[model samples]
Target chain A: MAPMSFAGKTIELDADGNLANRGDWSDDLARELAAQDGIAELTPQHWAVINFMRTVFEKDGDAPSIRRLTKESGVDTKMLYALFPKGPAKRAAKIAGLPKPKGCI
Target chain B: MTQTAEPIQKVSIIVSRGSLEGVYPGLIMANGARMEGIEASLFFTFFGLDAIIKKRMNSLKVATVGNPGMHMPTILGAIPGMSAFATSMMKKEIEKLDIPPIGEFITMIHDAGCEIYACKATVDMFHLKKDDFCEEVDGVISVGQFYEKAAGAQIIFT
Candidate 1:
């Protein structure tokens, strides 16, 4: 498959469809997302949760199971699901800004 | 020449749902935003808190009633098929269409530096301690604080 692109820029890829800019994080993404209702109000709990989600993606190239996320991050899965609505991996991936996870597709 | 402002301003979404159908839109939109480089956030409140809960996040079912256009697999879902099996099949189809798991998609947004918030009032109302939530959450905030962040940002409720 071809790479993902944004704003007239094609996503740079690695051998494994990995990203070229591993540390491409920018506050703009967060600010833009924060404008949305689901994400507008950030809390400490949410931050740790999303960050852990990113960590999982970075390490596994996939999202974490809720059980694993709770075990690893200590966030309440019940609560997380309530916040995400669409299953945590999918919801979190978008907010966290990694590519759509591989296995998810 | 008059300067043209950037179209497609950033917008954030708040999702508060416990059922499968309710959650899908939020997850889909958040990822969709990241795909388009728009900002997205998903704050869990009240019953919507389920997605953030680790153990229960996987097997969440969408309530059939009160949800229009939520097509269920009637033949398989009802006529002697395991609910788990049916649910997984449906989820797989969605995933095949590139729907990220709530957790994974949330991570992708964060990886791109999007915000995720938990509602403190909702947690308290539900009598949940902070220990009940995931570490990826930025922190807890009241609705007022949330609005402070949401100022000048597009707010969507899903």
Candidate 2:
């Protein structure tokens, strides 16, 4: 139940969407994540973007816009959808180890 | 406590053919991953092995009529000159999307940092050497080594 980093906090996944890293959360975001299923992976591409998104968040604590993401990674947009099969921003975000994105559903 | 999870940030795809149909999926996926900000890899093996063959990778073809679609693969095969027609059609569709030809796309993806692998066993099976492959390949690897790299990441057989 302890936070993974130097910070001392624990994220519990028992709730619908308890973040795996509560230390990474803002209070409001933590509560929101708790309201959904923890996180799910329906395909390989989901895992692909989720991993990349985590890196961006780690560097900035904020999710990159899709355009920024493409520019940064140099991958095409259509392919992201091909992998996710579920919407990219909405679904891939959860598995990527990020807080609920601001203004994102 | 939430599950103790590992963080993953990159992806690898395996491409083993130089043919139009066999190689494009891996290239498309690699490019797609790059677009998503994920590091993508393509490992080429066997006849798919041709996808990385420096001279042949770019010249792959769609199997037209005799492909698994039952009636199509053979019917297309029966037509004397239809193979070229099918290849051109495939090329047109890909061009419409602006996807480069198989060779160029592979090069682009590799330059974008998509790790490309040429299987050693397959190379031996086909009697090829590293120089026989395109520059995109990072190294020749065994299936075991491939597993080591692919462990925490997605393993796409395409």
Candidate 3:
């Protein structure tokens, strides 16, 4: 397990840099993680996606796939890429304090 | 051996078959690459153009006659409508796994920024014009143009 220090608190992370303990997650920690991923500020639109991811994870016990995020999250695929850049699904999961989604599409 | 490890940044996939099973592996790989922040492009050639052809894209069938994966006797597989039956069965299974249909899958990947192109030679051989393809197709290109676009990127043949 790797440990990351954020906002004077040390947190355990998995090999992929996702938070190891879901219980340790907080809104502040999400902001910190987003910052580390190069997002300067968390906009309302960002929160919409982060919160949607968290809500889905709570029920499904896994992060939603990119397809679900685009179809059900009120954010289209292009907008998702624009918001998260690079990899929206993986990066959004990391910032949302959820495990990496396993589906291919 | 002393070379440093570098992550893949781009992939250009060549799809040469048009069957449902033959086309999906390439589409899945391209979609997966895009999901990982890697740039991906798909080049459709020969029968692979069926995947982008407007009239055929949604109707791709499983090749029941010669496909051993179905474990069916070739004689039985050759029966009328056998390919359509197998294709429908596969579609049901795919739906159970939450996989979108071919048409929707193509649109989704295109929206996700995966580049799609058709081979000009194949288009000409089939007498297909650009309008004969689905809207998602970027354009038809020559092999030379494909090689140029694939420069510095990993090339995958499917």
Candidate 4:
């Protein structure tokens, strides 16, 4: 995947453009990636999903799937799509600088 | 002038198996699509009809006999009650994760705006009436109709 350069930090990305190193992630980096994904601004609802996904990844060793997101992220399914369009689990994970979620098609 | 990339607008999943393990992949994929802000649909055919039939949909069992993932040899997998044992284990694991049961999951998918369809040929072959399906079923449709709806959509078969 192409490298993403922002805020004077160049970060490697996986084939799907997720952060190659989790340590490379920051709120700034997430904002940049979210912009590239066509989300111009991160709302409180967006952070709710990103933070929930990152927390789940830290504890579970993988990002949450759609089912987990709807059931455990305190975000309803419709809002999840509105917050992270075209694939919430994948798009949110990418913007959150996490790996692609398993079973995310 | 440059052409911008177009977003995926829809996904169509063809679920052709009736096993407990077989059905979830399609459901998961469809749900994933809706979660992504895409329209989604599921076309159930053949033995997969069991996944929508009101009487059998909720009672799907994991097929251990021909399943290599079961880890048990086929001979041992055939032991009496093994299928039920595997089904119960799967159900327990799913519950442990707070995932809804089959019936509820189906309803959840429908409530989330995923269209559900039963194959007309399969319904006819099984002598099933419309009421025999879960109310979530949008319609009983022929393959031609399904393809018409699936046009320009990403198609997944599981």
Pairs of residues clashing in candidate 3: none
Task: Estimate, for each residue in A8-67, the C-alpha lDDT of model 2 and write its tens digit.
Answer: 544454232425553565533423432343433344444446557777788878666554
What ranking emerges by DockQ with the best candidate at the front?
A: 3, 4, 1, 2
TM-score each candidate: 0.53, 0.56, 0.95, 0.76
**Model 4 per-residue lDDT tens digits across residues B1-158:** 23586877999999999999999889877876776678999999999888888899889999989999999999989999999999999999887765677787887788678999999999999899999999999999999999999999999999
Q: What fraction of the native interface does candidate 2 get right in terms of contacts?
A: 0.00
lDDT of 3 by residue, B37-106 (tens): 8999999999999999889999999999888999999999999999999999999988776678888889
Interface RMS deviation of candidate 3: 1.0
Worst 10 residues of 2 chain A by lDDT: A30-39
Docking class of 4: acceptable
| Chain B only, TM-score of each candidate | 0.80, 0.86, 0.95, 0.94
Could you tell me which residue pairs clash in candidate 4?
A: A87-B36
> What's the distance in Å from true for residue B26, model 4?
3.0
Candidate 1 lDDT tens digits, B27-145:
66665554444656677777778877766666677554444454655543354445556467668877766556676656655554467788898888888777776666787888988
DockQ of every predicted complex? 0.06, 0.04, 0.76, 0.31
Residue A66, candidate 2: how far off, in angstroms?
13
Residue B14 lDDT (model 4):
96
Highest-scoring model, lDDT: 3
Q: Score each candidate by Cα lDDT.
A: 0.64, 0.63, 0.89, 0.86
